[model samples]
Target: MPILKFPPIESADEQGIVAIGGDLHVESLKLAYKKGIFPWPISEDYPLAWFSPNPRAVFDLNNIHIPKKLKKFINNCSYKITYNTAFERVIRKARDIHQNSIHGTWITEEVIAAYIQLFREGHAYSVEVWEDKELIGGLYGVCFGKFINGESMFHIKDNASKIALLSILSNIKRADIKYFDTQMITNVTGSLGAIEIERPDFLDYVANTTAEKEINFQNFSLHLDFDL
Candidate 1:
Protein backbone atom coordinates (compact mmCIF):
# COMPACT_ATOMS: atom_id res chain seq x y z
CA MET A 1 0.00 0.00 0.00
CA PRO A 2 1.11 3.53 -0.69
CA ILE A 3 1.82 5.83 2.24
CA LEU A 4 -0.91 8.07 3.56
CA LYS A 5 -0.10 11.76 3.93
CA PHE A 6 -1.85 14.16 6.30
CA PRO A 7 -2.37 17.86 5.83
CA PRO A 8 -0.70 20.45 8.04
CA ILE A 9 -2.08 20.65 11.57
CA GLU A 10 -2.84 24.32 11.04
CA SER A 11 -5.21 23.34 8.26
CA ALA A 12 -7.56 21.72 10.75
CA ASP A 13 -10.84 23.54 11.22
CA GLU A 14 -12.11 24.87 14.51
CA GLN A 15 -13.06 21.29 15.37
CA GLY A 16 -9.50 19.92 14.96
CA ILE A 17 -10.44 17.41 12.27
CA VAL A 18 -7.47 17.16 9.96
CA ALA A 19 -8.90 14.62 7.58
CA ILE A 20 -11.62 12.07 7.04
CA GLY A 21 -12.07 8.67 5.31
CA GLY A 22 -8.74 6.92 5.67
CA ASP A 23 -8.10 3.19 6.00
CA LEU A 24 -6.87 2.00 9.41
CA HIS A 25 -3.94 0.07 7.99
CA VAL A 26 -1.14 -0.21 10.53
CA GLU A 27 1.17 2.01 8.52
CA SER A 28 -1.45 4.75 8.25
CA LEU A 29 -2.08 4.49 11.96
CA LYS A 30 1.65 4.80 12.64
CA LEU A 31 2.05 7.87 10.49
CA ALA A 32 -1.00 9.54 11.98
CA TYR A 33 0.15 8.95 15.56
CA LYS A 34 3.71 10.01 14.87
CA LYS A 35 2.39 13.26 13.50
CA GLY A 36 0.30 13.84 16.64
CA ILE A 37 -2.96 12.91 14.97
CA PHE A 38 -5.36 10.05 15.77
CA PRO A 39 -8.46 8.43 14.38
CA TRP A 40 -11.87 8.92 15.97
CA PRO A 41 -14.65 7.48 13.87
CA ILE A 42 -17.76 9.62 13.93
CA SER A 43 -20.24 6.81 13.29
CA GLU A 44 -21.01 3.95 10.91
CA ASP A 45 -22.53 6.40 8.48
CA TYR A 46 -19.44 8.59 8.28
CA PRO A 47 -15.94 7.65 7.25
CA LEU A 48 -13.09 7.58 9.74
CA ALA A 49 -11.94 10.91 11.14
CA TRP A 50 -8.52 12.08 12.23
CA PHE A 51 -7.91 14.75 14.84
CA SER A 52 -5.13 16.92 16.19
CA PRO A 53 -7.21 18.78 18.65
CA ASN A 54 -6.18 22.26 19.65
CA PRO A 55 -5.80 22.83 23.36
CA ARG A 56 -4.65 19.21 23.70
CA ALA A 57 -5.00 17.63 27.10
CA VAL A 58 -2.06 16.05 28.87
CA PHE A 59 -0.98 15.02 32.36
CA ASP A 60 2.03 16.91 33.55
CA LEU A 61 3.67 13.78 34.91
CA ASN A 62 5.47 15.59 37.72
CA ASN A 63 2.24 17.02 39.07
CA ILE A 64 -0.58 14.46 38.77
CA HIS A 65 -3.16 15.06 41.48
CA ILE A 66 -4.68 12.12 43.31
CA PRO A 67 -7.92 12.96 45.04
CA LYS A 68 -7.72 12.09 48.74
CA LYS A 69 -10.37 9.39 48.36
CA LEU A 70 -8.71 7.91 45.28
CA LYS A 71 -5.38 7.93 47.02
CA LYS A 72 -6.90 6.08 49.93
CA PHE A 73 -8.50 3.53 47.57
CA ILE A 74 -5.14 2.97 45.86
CA ASN A 75 -3.41 2.37 49.17
CA ASN A 76 -6.11 -0.04 50.28
CA CYS A 77 -7.10 -1.91 47.09
CA SER A 78 -5.97 -5.46 46.51
CA TYR A 79 -5.95 -5.22 42.71
CA LYS A 80 -2.89 -6.48 40.89
CA ILE A 81 -1.54 -4.58 37.90
CA THR A 82 0.21 -5.84 34.78
CA TYR A 83 1.61 -4.24 31.65
CA ASN A 84 1.02 -5.38 28.06
CA THR A 85 -0.52 -8.59 29.39
CA ALA A 86 -4.05 -8.41 27.94
CA PHE A 87 -4.07 -5.47 25.53
CA GLU A 88 -6.82 -6.69 23.21
CA ARG A 89 -8.98 -7.48 26.21
CA VAL A 90 -8.52 -3.97 27.56
CA ILE A 91 -9.37 -2.33 24.22
CA ARG A 92 -12.46 -4.48 23.77
CA LYS A 93 -13.66 -3.74 27.27
CA ALA A 94 -13.24 -0.03 26.63
CA ARG A 95 -15.23 -0.50 23.43
CA ASP A 96 -18.04 -2.28 25.24
CA ILE A 97 -18.25 0.36 27.94
CA HIS A 98 -18.42 3.15 25.38
CA GLN A 99 -20.82 1.30 23.08
CA ASN A 100 -23.30 0.89 25.89
CA SER A 101 -23.16 4.57 26.71
CA ILE A 102 -25.63 7.13 25.34
CA HIS A 103 -22.78 8.86 23.50
CA GLY A 104 -21.81 5.66 21.63
CA THR A 105 -18.24 4.84 20.66
CA TRP A 106 -15.67 5.01 17.87
CA ILE A 107 -14.00 1.73 18.76
CA THR A 108 -15.36 -0.17 15.80
CA GLU A 109 -14.07 -3.58 14.71
CA GLU A 110 -11.65 -1.81 12.39
CA VAL A 111 -10.19 0.28 15.21
CA ILE A 112 -9.83 -2.77 17.47
CA ALA A 113 -8.06 -4.81 14.81
CA ALA A 114 -5.71 -1.99 13.91
CA TYR A 115 -4.75 -1.34 17.53
CA ILE A 116 -4.28 -5.05 18.21
CA GLN A 117 -1.84 -5.16 15.33
CA LEU A 118 -0.07 -2.11 16.78
CA PHE A 119 0.19 -3.90 20.11
CA ARG A 120 1.65 -6.97 18.48
CA GLU A 121 4.20 -4.74 16.77
CA GLY A 122 5.24 -3.17 20.12
CA HIS A 123 4.03 0.34 19.33
CA ALA A 124 1.15 0.10 21.80
CA TYR A 125 0.89 -0.85 25.48
CA SER A 126 -1.70 -1.72 28.10
CA VAL A 127 -1.99 -1.50 31.88
CA GLU A 128 -4.38 -4.06 33.30
CA VAL A 129 -5.90 -4.27 36.78
CA TRP A 130 -6.96 -7.65 38.11
CA GLU A 131 -8.41 -9.11 41.29
CA ASP A 132 -6.99 -12.55 41.75
CA LYS A 133 -8.02 -14.18 38.45
CA GLU A 134 -10.58 -11.62 37.35
CA LEU A 135 -9.73 -8.59 35.21
CA ILE A 136 -11.50 -5.44 36.37
CA GLY A 137 -10.03 -2.35 34.68
CA GLY A 138 -7.28 -1.19 32.32
CA LEU A 139 -6.04 1.27 29.69
CA TYR A 140 -4.22 1.05 26.34
CA GLY A 141 -2.40 3.59 24.18
CA VAL A 142 0.15 4.15 21.45
CA CYS A 143 3.67 5.01 22.48
CA PHE A 144 6.43 6.73 20.55
CA GLY A 145 9.65 6.71 22.45
CA LYS A 146 8.89 8.52 25.71
CA PHE A 147 5.63 10.10 24.53
CA ILE A 148 2.47 8.11 25.27
CA ASN A 149 -0.91 8.93 23.78
CA GLY A 150 -3.41 7.29 26.13
CA GLU A 151 -6.33 6.23 23.96
CA SER A 152 -8.98 4.85 26.29
CA MET A 153 -9.64 3.19 29.63
CA PHE A 154 -12.49 1.32 31.30
CA HIS A 155 -13.39 -0.14 34.67
CA ILE A 156 -15.76 -2.89 35.77
CA LYS A 157 -15.28 -2.17 39.46
CA ASP A 158 -15.33 1.11 41.30
CA ASN A 159 -12.18 3.21 40.73
CA ALA A 160 -10.52 0.30 38.98
CA SER A 161 -9.64 2.30 35.86
CA LYS A 162 -8.25 5.11 37.99
CA ILE A 163 -6.08 2.57 39.75
CA ALA A 164 -4.83 1.27 36.42
CA LEU A 165 -3.99 4.85 35.40
CA LEU A 166 -2.11 5.62 38.60
CA SER A 167 -0.17 2.41 38.28
CA ILE A 168 0.86 3.23 34.72
CA LEU A 169 1.69 6.84 35.65
CA SER A 170 3.95 5.71 38.47
CA ASN A 171 5.73 3.29 36.19
CA ILE A 172 6.11 5.82 33.38
CA LYS A 173 7.25 8.49 35.79
CA ARG A 174 10.08 6.24 36.87
CA ALA A 175 11.02 5.96 33.17
CA ASP A 176 11.43 9.78 33.08
CA ILE A 177 8.66 10.73 30.69
CA LYS A 178 7.35 14.23 31.45
CA TYR A 179 3.90 14.16 29.88
CA PHE A 180 0.97 11.79 29.33
CA ASP A 181 -1.40 12.68 26.53
CA THR A 182 -5.03 12.03 27.43
CA GLN A 183 -6.19 13.54 24.09
CA MET A 184 -9.33 15.41 25.13
CA ILE A 185 -9.93 16.29 28.72
CA THR A 186 -12.98 15.21 30.64
CA ASN A 187 -14.03 16.01 34.16
CA VAL A 188 -12.37 12.87 35.42
CA THR A 189 -9.04 13.73 33.82
CA GLY A 190 -9.26 17.41 34.73
CA SER A 191 -9.75 16.42 38.34
CA LEU A 192 -6.63 14.27 38.07
CA GLY A 193 -4.45 17.23 36.93
CA ALA A 194 -4.83 17.16 33.16
CA ILE A 195 -4.11 20.51 31.56
CA GLU A 196 -4.63 21.94 28.09
CA ILE A 197 -2.02 23.45 25.81
CA GLU A 198 -2.05 24.94 22.33
CA ARG A 199 -1.70 22.46 19.46
CA PRO A 200 1.53 24.03 18.23
CA ASP A 201 3.04 23.70 21.68
CA PHE A 202 1.85 20.11 21.90
CA LEU A 203 3.32 19.24 18.52
CA ASP A 204 6.57 20.90 19.43
CA TYR A 205 6.73 18.95 22.65
CA VAL A 206 6.11 15.68 20.78
CA ALA A 207 8.83 16.47 18.26
CA ASN A 208 11.45 17.31 20.86
CA THR A 209 10.55 14.73 23.52
CA THR A 210 10.44 11.53 21.46
CA ALA A 211 13.69 9.69 21.03
CA GLU A 212 14.96 6.49 19.45
CA LYS A 213 14.99 4.95 22.89
CA GLU A 214 12.00 2.64 23.42
CA ILE A 215 10.31 1.80 26.71
CA ASN A 216 10.26 -1.88 27.65
CA PHE A 217 6.62 -2.26 28.55
CA GLN A 218 7.12 -5.96 29.22
CA ASN A 219 9.63 -5.08 31.92
CA PHE A 220 7.40 -2.40 33.47
CA SER A 221 4.61 -3.45 35.84
CA LEU A 222 3.01 -1.68 38.74
CA HIS A 223 4.31 -2.27 42.26
CA LEU A 224 1.40 -2.54 44.65
CA ASP A 225 3.02 -0.21 47.14
CA PHE A 226 2.97 3.18 45.40
CA ASP A 227 3.53 6.85 46.24
CA LEU A 228 0.98 9.24 44.59
Candidate 2:
Protein backbone atom coordinates (compact mmCIF):
# COMPACT_ATOMS: atom_id res chain seq x y z
CA MET A 1 0.00 0.00 0.00
CA PRO A 2 1.28 3.46 -0.90
CA ILE A 3 0.98 6.57 1.24
CA LEU A 4 -1.14 9.50 0.09
CA LYS A 5 -0.70 13.22 0.73
CA PHE A 6 -2.96 16.12 -0.23
CA PRO A 7 -2.86 19.89 -0.18
CA PRO A 8 -5.30 21.80 2.01
CA ILE A 9 -8.94 21.80 0.93
CA GLU A 10 -8.90 25.61 0.79
CA SER A 11 -6.17 25.25 -1.83
CA ALA A 12 -8.49 23.50 -4.29
CA ASP A 13 -8.95 25.59 -7.42
CA GLU A 14 -12.29 27.01 -8.51
CA GLN A 15 -12.85 23.56 -10.02
CA GLY A 16 -12.51 21.90 -6.53
CA ILE A 17 -9.28 20.11 -7.32
CA VAL A 18 -7.04 20.31 -4.25
CA ALA A 19 -4.01 18.27 -5.23
CA ILE A 20 -2.75 15.48 -7.44
CA GLY A 21 -0.60 12.34 -7.74
CA GLY A 22 -1.25 10.44 -4.50
CA ASP A 23 -2.10 6.76 -4.41
CA LEU A 24 -5.25 5.92 -2.46
CA HIS A 25 -3.83 4.43 0.71
CA VAL A 26 -6.18 3.90 3.66
CA GLU A 27 -4.46 6.50 5.85
CA SER A 28 -4.40 9.09 3.05
CA LEU A 29 -7.94 8.28 1.96
CA LYS A 30 -9.21 8.72 5.51
CA LEU A 31 -7.31 11.98 5.78
CA ALA A 32 -8.80 13.16 2.50
CA TYR A 33 -12.36 12.48 3.66
CA LYS A 34 -11.77 14.15 7.00
CA LYS A 35 -10.68 17.34 5.24
CA GLY A 36 -13.61 17.35 2.74
CA ILE A 37 -11.56 16.10 -0.21
CA PHE A 38 -12.13 13.14 -2.53
CA PRO A 39 -10.27 11.75 -5.51
CA TRP A 40 -11.61 11.98 -9.06
CA PRO A 41 -8.91 10.85 -11.38
CA ILE A 42 -8.67 12.81 -14.62
CA SER A 43 -7.89 9.66 -16.56
CA GLU A 44 -6.22 6.29 -16.11
CA ASP A 45 -3.23 7.99 -17.67
CA TYR A 46 -3.12 10.66 -14.98
CA PRO A 47 -2.38 10.69 -11.26
CA LEU A 48 -5.24 11.00 -8.79
CA ALA A 49 -6.79 14.42 -8.45
CA TRP A 50 -8.60 15.28 -5.24
CA PHE A 51 -11.68 17.51 -5.12
CA SER A 52 -14.04 19.19 -2.68
CA PRO A 53 -16.45 20.98 -4.95
CA ASN A 54 -18.00 24.18 -3.72
CA PRO A 55 -21.77 24.07 -3.74
CA ARG A 56 -21.33 20.47 -2.68
CA ALA A 57 -24.13 18.07 -3.53
CA VAL A 58 -25.88 16.31 -0.66
CA PHE A 59 -29.17 14.80 0.51
CA ASP A 60 -30.60 16.63 3.46
CA LEU A 61 -31.91 13.77 5.57
CA ASN A 62 -34.93 15.88 6.41
CA ASN A 63 -35.72 16.57 2.75
CA ILE A 64 -34.94 13.33 0.90
CA HIS A 65 -37.43 12.33 -1.81
CA ILE A 66 -38.27 8.90 -3.11
CA PRO A 67 -39.78 9.08 -6.58
CA LYS A 68 -43.24 7.50 -6.85
CA LYS A 69 -42.21 4.85 -9.35
CA LEU A 70 -39.19 3.80 -7.33
CA LYS A 71 -41.31 3.67 -4.22
CA LYS A 72 -43.77 1.49 -6.07
CA PHE A 73 -40.94 -0.69 -7.27
CA ILE A 74 -39.77 -1.19 -3.69
CA ASN A 75 -43.28 -2.02 -2.60
CA ASN A 76 -43.84 -4.44 -5.46
CA CYS A 77 -40.44 -6.01 -5.88
CA SER A 78 -39.08 -9.10 -4.21
CA TYR A 79 -35.43 -8.55 -3.49
CA LYS A 80 -32.89 -8.77 -0.71
CA ILE A 81 -30.47 -6.12 0.56
CA THR A 82 -27.44 -6.16 2.82
CA TYR A 83 -24.73 -3.81 3.99
CA ASN A 84 -21.00 -4.42 4.36
CA THR A 85 -21.54 -8.05 3.46
CA ALA A 86 -19.84 -7.81 0.09
CA PHE A 87 -17.90 -4.60 -0.01
CA GLU A 88 -15.34 -5.58 -2.61
CA ARG A 89 -17.91 -7.08 -4.96
CA VAL A 90 -20.20 -4.09 -4.64
CA ILE A 91 -17.39 -1.64 -5.43
CA ARG A 92 -16.20 -3.65 -8.41
CA LYS A 93 -19.70 -4.04 -9.79
CA ALA A 94 -20.31 -0.33 -9.40
CA ARG A 95 -17.07 0.36 -11.22
CA ASP A 96 -17.76 -1.99 -14.11
CA ILE A 97 -21.34 -0.84 -14.44
CA HIS A 98 -20.21 2.75 -14.44
CA GLN A 99 -17.56 1.99 -17.04
CA ASN A 100 -20.25 0.59 -19.37
CA SER A 101 -22.41 3.67 -18.97
CA ILE A 102 -19.59 6.12 -19.76
CA HIS A 103 -16.43 6.11 -21.84
CA GLY A 104 -14.11 5.20 -18.96
CA THR A 105 -13.99 4.28 -15.29
CA TRP A 106 -12.26 5.98 -12.37
CA ILE A 107 -12.42 2.85 -10.27
CA THR A 108 -8.93 1.92 -11.34
CA GLU A 109 -7.28 -1.20 -9.98
CA GLU A 110 -5.37 1.03 -7.55
CA VAL A 111 -8.57 2.67 -6.40
CA ILE A 112 -10.20 -0.72 -5.90
CA ALA A 113 -7.36 -1.99 -3.77
CA ALA A 114 -7.39 1.20 -1.71
CA TYR A 115 -11.10 1.04 -0.95
CA ILE A 116 -11.05 -2.67 -0.23
CA GLN A 117 -8.45 -1.93 2.42
CA LEU A 118 -10.58 0.90 3.71
CA PHE A 119 -13.46 -1.52 4.04
CA ARG A 120 -11.27 -3.94 5.94
CA GLU A 121 -10.46 -1.20 8.44
CA GLY A 122 -14.15 -0.23 8.64
CA HIS A 123 -13.66 3.20 7.05
CA ALA A 124 -15.98 2.22 4.19
CA TYR A 125 -19.27 0.42 3.63
CA SER A 126 -21.33 -0.93 0.71
CA VAL A 127 -24.95 -1.71 0.06
CA GLU A 128 -25.73 -4.76 -2.04
CA VAL A 129 -29.01 -5.45 -3.87
CA TRP A 130 -29.82 -8.97 -4.91
CA GLU A 131 -32.53 -10.52 -7.07
CA ASP A 132 -33.17 -14.25 -7.13
CA LYS A 133 -29.91 -14.70 -5.26
CA GLU A 134 -27.96 -12.91 -7.97
CA LEU A 135 -26.36 -9.53 -7.42
CA ILE A 136 -28.24 -6.93 -9.43
CA GLY A 137 -27.22 -3.58 -8.00
CA GLY A 138 -24.98 -1.93 -5.40
CA LEU A 139 -23.03 1.15 -4.36
CA TYR A 140 -20.08 1.98 -2.15
CA GLY A 141 -18.42 5.01 -0.54
CA VAL A 142 -16.35 6.29 2.32
CA CYS A 143 -17.80 6.85 5.80
CA PHE A 144 -16.35 9.56 7.94
CA GLY A 145 -18.12 9.87 11.29
CA LYS A 146 -21.66 11.31 10.75
CA PHE A 147 -21.12 11.93 7.05
CA ILE A 148 -20.92 9.56 4.10
CA ASN A 149 -19.45 10.31 0.68
CA GLY A 150 -21.27 8.24 -1.93
CA GLU A 151 -18.83 7.30 -4.66
CA SER A 152 -20.70 5.31 -7.31
CA MET A 153 -23.63 3.02 -7.94
CA PHE A 154 -24.94 0.77 -10.74
CA HIS A 155 -27.91 -1.44 -11.44
CA ILE A 156 -28.68 -4.16 -13.95
CA LYS A 157 -32.34 -4.28 -13.01
CA ASP A 158 -34.63 -1.28 -12.91
CA ASN A 159 -34.62 0.42 -9.51
CA ALA A 160 -31.99 -1.87 -8.09
CA SER A 161 -29.64 0.98 -7.23
CA LYS A 162 -32.51 2.93 -5.76
CA ILE A 163 -33.28 0.02 -3.51
CA ALA A 164 -29.70 0.06 -2.32
CA LEU A 165 -30.05 3.77 -1.55
CA LEU A 166 -33.30 3.30 0.36
CA SER A 167 -31.62 0.71 2.48
CA ILE A 168 -29.01 3.27 3.50
CA LEU A 169 -31.41 6.15 4.22
CA SER A 170 -33.90 4.02 6.10
CA ASN A 171 -31.19 2.94 8.48
CA ILE A 172 -29.58 6.30 9.06
CA LYS A 173 -30.80 6.43 12.61
CA ARG A 174 -29.25 3.12 13.48
CA ALA A 175 -26.09 4.09 11.67
CA ASP A 176 -26.06 7.47 13.45
CA ILE A 177 -25.31 9.21 10.18
CA LYS A 178 -26.46 12.82 9.86
CA TYR A 179 -25.87 13.57 6.17
CA PHE A 180 -25.62 11.54 2.98
CA ASP A 181 -23.37 13.13 0.36
CA THR A 182 -23.52 12.24 -3.31
CA GLN A 183 -20.39 14.36 -4.00
CA MET A 184 -21.78 15.60 -7.30
CA ILE A 185 -25.32 16.44 -8.33
CA THR A 186 -26.73 14.60 -11.32
CA ASN A 187 -30.14 14.03 -12.88
CA VAL A 188 -30.32 10.74 -11.03
CA THR A 189 -29.40 12.10 -7.61
CA GLY A 190 -31.39 15.30 -8.07
CA SER A 191 -34.50 13.27 -8.87
CA LEU A 192 -33.82 11.30 -5.71
CA GLY A 193 -33.70 14.47 -3.59
CA ALA A 194 -30.09 15.68 -3.50
CA ILE A 195 -29.17 19.36 -3.28
CA GLU A 196 -26.12 21.56 -3.51
CA ILE A 197 -24.83 23.45 -0.47
CA GLU A 198 -21.73 25.53 0.11
CA ARG A 199 -18.54 23.67 0.91
CA PRO A 200 -18.22 25.40 4.27
CA ASP A 201 -21.61 24.00 5.23
CA PHE A 202 -20.44 20.56 4.23
CA LEU A 203 -17.30 21.11 6.27
CA ASP A 204 -19.44 22.02 9.24
CA TYR A 205 -21.34 18.77 8.89
CA VAL A 206 -18.30 16.49 8.71
CA ALA A 207 -15.57 18.34 10.55
CA ASN A 208 -14.81 16.89 13.98
CA THR A 209 -18.28 15.32 14.01
CA THR A 210 -18.28 11.63 14.85
CA ALA A 211 -20.75 8.79 14.48
CA GLU A 212 -19.44 5.35 13.86
CA LYS A 213 -21.86 2.55 13.01
CA GLU A 214 -23.62 1.83 16.31
CA ILE A 215 -25.85 -0.99 15.10
CA ASN A 216 -24.80 -4.17 13.41
CA PHE A 217 -25.46 -4.01 9.67
CA GLN A 218 -27.20 -7.38 9.85
CA ASN A 219 -29.70 -5.83 12.19
CA PHE A 220 -30.43 -2.89 9.91
CA SER A 221 -33.54 -2.84 7.72
CA LEU A 222 -35.33 -0.39 5.44
CA HIS A 223 -38.68 0.65 6.87
CA LEU A 224 -39.97 2.89 4.12
CA ASP A 225 -42.56 5.64 4.40
CA PHE A 226 -41.39 6.85 0.92
CA ASP A 227 -42.67 10.41 1.53
CA LEU A 228 -45.72 9.88 -0.68
Q: Top TM-score: which candidate number?
A: 1
In model 2, state the lDDT of residue 123: 76
User: Which residue runs does candidate 2 get wrong by more than 4 Å?
Assistant: 1-5, 173-176, 211-216, 222-228
Q: Write the per-residue lDDT of candidate 1 for residues 101-157, one digit (tens) a residue.
A: 999988999889999999888889999999998999999999888878789999999
Q: Which window of ten consecutive residues has the lowest lDDT sum in model 2? A: 208-217
Give the Å shift of residue 75 in candidate 2: 0.9
Compute the lDDT for candidate 1: 0.86
Candidate 2's error at 180, in angstroms?
A: 0.5
Residue by residue across 1-228, what tens digits does model 2's lDDT show? 544556667888999988877677778888888878888877788878888999899887777788767777788888788788888888888888878775678888888998998888877889888888899998888776666767888899998888788677667645556578889888878897888999998888777553443235566774444332
Best by lDDT: 1
Instruction: Provide the overall lDDT of each model, using Cα atoms, as 2-decimal numbers.
Output: 0.86, 0.78
